[model samples]
Target: MNNIEFIRNEEKKYHDFCYENYKLFEEGSWLYKPVKTVMDLLPLFDNNESLNVIDLGCGVGRNSIPIAEAIKNKNGKVVCVDLLDSALNKLKEYSKQYKVEKVIRTEKADIGNYKIKPNEFDFIIAVSALEHVKSEEVFEEVVRQMPEGTKNNGVNCLIINSEVQEIDLETNEKLDVLMELNLSIEVMMNKLSSIYTGWEVLKTVVNPLEYNITRSEKPVLLKTNAITYVVRKSIG
Candidate 1:
């Protein structure tokens, strides 16, 4: 299958299945929890009342719910964007359940095509989302826009998967990696550096992880280098 087809299929299979069967933060599920790193960096903006944040590929408000809860008193807003109707629907339901509906907004759009408004956000996060973009160029463009979309003293947190290697468990042989834009570690780092120059780099980490899963009805082991980058836009 081609790139777009592969992406759609993967999205339908993984995202649809996961969001359908598993409750957010359900025990033993991949969606068991939100990224702690994202949670950790939130306090940096604590002093900013009226917070505005963007969560690209926010699935079912795992992180967005907590974010809304944190900033609700401050009149904070978290714009949760995803391509799936089901995801957005669940997010809305959960926001009301958590009593943070007033602080949450949902947008249905593919993150690749979703434009970030200039200086419109206090914080922007895309966790394991940008890799699914159509191409490396698209990825770079999105990364370039991240800082531009942030207000001064605001932050951008990105957790991207790079250098994916899928292995067939039974045969012990490598299989075709299915992500749309499987960028190399070097390339990913270089682009972030070039685009986010002069920003206060808070964190840069590369964690290698392995997961066993059934894909296309076959048991496979997926390996990836998860890159986490957090930076702040210095006030001029």
Candidate 2:
């Protein structure tokens, strides 16, 4: 199929899967908890009286919920954006359940097409989200906008999956990976390094991961290199 068709199919798959998974923060699941790295960085903005944060493609407030709790007392707001309505609906429920409803605002939009205002946010996070953009060009443009939208001394934390491969466990046959912008490890690193030039690289890590997952009722072995790159925008 063509790129657009593939992307549409992928979106539907995710939408259905998200709707089926009613619980967030469930034990032993991929969404078991928020990323520790994201939580660790929240203390850096403790002194700010009012904080503005953006979470691109935030799935059911996995990271957004904790961030809202951290900044609730300081008039902090976490703008949670996702393409799926079900995810956002669940996030709203969780926000109310956690008593931080006032701190979160939800927006439904494709991350690639979402516009971020310049120098507006103290923290911008896109976890396991960038790789789903429509293409590598869109990925670069979004990355370009991320730092531009971040205020000086602000942070941008991105967790992207690269070099994804899937194999049918039952037949040991290779299957087409559904990612929209599945760049090679080398290309992905180069793009980040070039775009984030002069920024303070607080953390840079690449973890090779292989896991078993069920997709379309078939067991599959998914292999990917998960890259975490966190940087602070430098002030002139």
lDDT of 1 by residue, 172-195 (tens): 999888888888899999999999
Q: Which stretches of candidate 1 lie over 4 Å from their true place?
A: none
lDDT tens digits, residues 65-120, model 2? 98999899998899999988778988999999999999999999999999999999
Best by TM-score: 1
Could you tell me the TM-score of candidate 1?
A: 0.96
- Stretches of candidate 2 exceeding 4 Å from the true structure: none
RMSD of 1: 1.3
